[model samples]
Target: MQQGSSAHAIVVLARGRARVERSLLSSDVLPLGYRGAGDMAGESALVGMESYTENVIAMEDCDVVRVPTSTATALLRDDPALMQALVSTVLQRQAEAEERLTSLLFRPVEGRVVEFLLQAMSRWGVPDARGTVISAPITHLEIAKAIGSTRETVTVTLGVLRREGLLATAGRKLIVVDRDALAMRK
Candidate 1:
């Protein structure tokens, strides 16, 4: 869903992955984070917002359940447990966003790139004989947006990692060839 659009429904992602982003006035889109199974979007609608505050874009094929705002609001009002769960979800996501923003502000671009790669690997990595392969086909531009850097910077950083034998490219994905060697590395 596009940012600033009227919130019609809260989308529950039942399967697959999606990217969450926010747009700046300069027409730049910044990646907020990724969402996968059991995650949700348009949650502001349930809390009585006029429009969604962020964009949620599917990165691959997905199965989503759309719950109308009215229905979700009513359900939240009626079910204490569900309300509690929603509250927890909101808080957790907020905390993660805070951490991400903080990292962008303080960490060097290369460190951010490595951290992002490691996080992606942990999230979607499949064990390979060579190393841990990230299953998703994440582009450099997407990684750049996520880590608050230019695509060129991310590409160079990845190349550096590969040269150091810490990372490897496999088709559209990447592999973490030496996890320990990359720890807190510059």
Candidate 2:
């Protein structure tokens, strides 16, 4: 969805798709193809772009609250809490993109799988007695797509994690067994 210059508009969609076309006019730093978060969206200087792009890319059948870019600017004008949320969201996306870039460039295939899992946990994980469980359901193919790997690779890597007790597959869900241990893989 397009935004106005002076007004902050929240774009809420029960179900739709958002393709982050371009941000050339909006920011000084021009962007390339859409990366999941920061790589394609940029930093906190462009928080609205990050939030809007992510919700468009990752979420499905979900509820989203859009704080109009203008409203967000005004709230940031006065309220520290809103400012922090905006900054954190942008930085978090940037961090996620950096981690993925590292995996894509330097890490091994297995390590990349772990990175994907950890990223998902950070975004949609729910704490449980065993560990943190992914709040949203995802498939091996989807994970493979996110990491630029094959579905077979994802399946094998997941099997290895299961053997090592890092995760457990319960029905269709992947439940994390040891978050700290998994995070320390790198």
Best by TM-score: 1
Where model 1 places Cα greater than 4 Å from the true spot, the runs are none
Where's the lowest-lDDT run of ten residues in candidate 2? 30-39
lDDT by residue (64-161, candidate 2, tens digit) is 45555565567678988866876786677578667668778998878888877886787667888878888666789767766677889989989988
lDDT of 2: 0.62
Q: lDDT for every model?
A: 0.89, 0.62
lDDT of 1: 0.89
lDDT of 1 by residue, 1-186 (tens): 878899889999999999988888998887778888988888988767889989998999999999999899899999999999999988988898888888889999988988898889888989999899999879999999888889999999999999989998889889999888876573
- The segments of candidate 2 whose C-alpha lies over 4 angstroms from its true place after superposition are 1-8, 11-61, 78-81
| Top-lDDT structure, candidate number | 1
Clashes of each: 0, 6
Q: TM-score of the candidate numbered 1? A: 0.92
Ten residues in a row with the worst lDDT in model 1? 177-186
